[model samples]
Target: MSISVVILAAGQGTRMKSTTPKVLHEISGKSMLFHAIDAAKKISDDITVVLYHQAARIQESIEAHYSGIHFHMQDAVQFPGTGGAMKGVHVTHSKALILNGDMPLVTMNALESLMQGDADINMSVIKLDNPSGYGRVVISEGSVVEIVEEKDCKPEQKEIQTVNAGVYCVKKELLESYIPALSNDNAQKEYYLTDIIKMAVDEGKPVHPVIVEEEEFKGVNSKLDLAHAEEILQRRIKTEWMKAGVSMRLPETIYIDSRATFEGECMLENGVSIQGASHIIASHIKTHSVIEDAYIQNSDVGPMGRIRPNTKLINTHIGNFVEVKKSTLTGVKAGHLAYIGDATVEEGSNIGAGVITCNYDGKNKYQTNIGKNVFVGSDTQLVAPVTIEDDVIIAAGSTINKNVAQGELAISRAPMKTIKGFFYKFFGEK
Candidate 1:
């Protein structure tokens, strides 16, 4: 039997209190709907997504990410509810696995098990210690008798541990047959997808309830819930990394994007963070090279380069003993200690300690170009738009604004004045 997945994504999730579609909200920079669709693709190649609110935009996003999945538009009048939305998708006589768009953390294995159940209609159930606000499952003789919503459930039924999880697997024919008979007969006057369970039992159809763990059934309806889900997912990912050979210092404190990759034997020390599609390949790091809070994309950091924390490096190269930040250092180098920003230090330059390229003109940014082998002296501020030619030596504590010629020593300082008798002249009586 072919297993086809149908994802019901029509709900606007008003409880989320945002205009953005709920499924489009990102978890680790990926849309939640994408995660759900990815899970479905593992089991069934035939997939259908039903869309209504923000329909055009959602369709465009899905088309950009996935090519072959089918889209079914929910008609406003004909299909007014989620159950109605599922009814609108006409899959060709396949065992239908229905998924909610809001639950991004549901595992592929759980879905596979639900699909394999192959009951006439199988409800994914989870046991809740306090099933107060949720629907309570009423099972009789090892079969689901009914799922009563909390408001309608009797006091005794409220004590039931098993609760309807809102995910289901059903044979297509039975669903299409009973969907037309569903009525909006509840407190909210909305036709619940759970109503189908009661419909099945009333007709003496076999209803099976498969118990899934509590985590697999969690759904997001609020921002707080979304944060909780992300935390759970991050912890799960960190655990997997530890199981594999990577070492993490204070894994709980690390906030790594799900897409970021690290090679084995790489140590992520406390407060060391990598973000934004940066990849590391088999490199060792010396201690205290804090790459703290950096957005490094498509660049490799040398083992000894001091990428002093809070810097943004993009498409650049960094060499040893270099401190860069609050500036863009692309294709520039300081073979030694140099504050290079808003300035370009050309290749093969030895920048001594106390070398400051003053690229700020108190009005706007300026570029200071230092040619190769230009020995910039200690405590020298090269006022920018200035070029130091090849083999130029700038004197210590000099402010060089004009270009220095090749093999020239340029210096700018006040002329010395002697004051031998000034103290005695001022205090002659003493």
Candidate 2:
């Protein structure tokens, strides 16, 4: 059966105490709402996101990343609450999987389980030792009879250990029929989506409770909860990479972005961070190095090096304190203290320590190209719009602005003078 997805993201999230919308907060480098949408995409593409607080901003952000998403605006004045978020929304499938946007850890497997039973309403529930803050799910004869919110629960109902997991899969027709008639008679003075359970039970419709793991349903409401969720997602990402033949010295200290992927036995040392869609193929990243949005293959990057965006390294060795940005190095070795930006160093090239590519000249950026078998000595500066041809040699401490032809030597140092007593004369020494 085809199922549509409805993600409720209209809440103010006042507990989060930020100008940013709650659903926009990130977990493992992705917003919580996007995570919910991602899981929903795994099941169906007919997805609708309901928004109220900062609706325009949220819509704009989401539209930049996704297409064909149906956005619904909730009427906060006339209709308010989870049930109100679905007001006037249409579903294209037989069933609609309603999800809370704050639950970033919700997975596709857990959602697939909700589609198992043949019931009018499939509600997710988890048994907790202390279910204080959540609504209680009252079950009778293996079916959910009612859902009592925490504020209105009686003393006996308060002790119910089975709590609503805030996720539901309901028949499209039932949602269309019941949501319009929901009453706001509760203590919260809002139309509760949980009221649909009692409505279904009153008519003797089957409402099955699907028990799910607590970790997958964790909701992020405050800064503390966001941190906790980040840790959980980080651990999950690292564990999956390690299982896929990637090795890490201290897994806890290494941070990997969710969008990053590795292939064919890569290794990372302690304090290494890889971010922003980096792809590593059989490379070894040493301690304290950071790589961002770069492709590295069969290379060794420093004990303290940084590879910035748009860089590609193949069989290269970038040593300590080296930073490469927007450049490609092939079979090259830059062992220490160099910055190579907006440049390309071809095969069999050696970039000595303290070398820099003066690519930016305070107005516009330019490129520096070094051909095969080129040797750039220590403290050499290759100015922008310069090229060193094949088999060219650059002397130490030279600043070259002009291109060097093939098999030529380029040097720009001033000629030494024989000022024997210059130091003593300058210092006024005897």
TM-scores vs. true structure, each candidate: 0.73, 0.95
In candidate 2, stretches whose alpha carbon ends up further than 4 angstroms from where it belongs are 151-155, 417-430
Q: Which structure among the candidates has the greatest lDDT?
A: 2
What is the C-alpha local distance difference test score of each model? Answer: 0.73, 0.94
- The residue-level lDDT of candidate 1 at 23 comes to 88
RMSD to true structure for each model, in Å: 5.9, 1.8
lDDT of 1 by residue, 117-212 (tens): 557888888998877788788988989998777888887988899998878888888778877777777565665677788788888888898889
Question: Candidate 2 at 314: error in angstroms?
Answer: 0.7
Q: How many backbone clashes does candidate 2 have?
A: 0
Q: What is the lDDT of residue 280 in candidate 1?
A: 47
TM-score of 2: 0.95
Question: Across residues 210-236, which tens digit of lDDT does each residue of candidate 2 receive?
Answer: 999999999999999999998999999
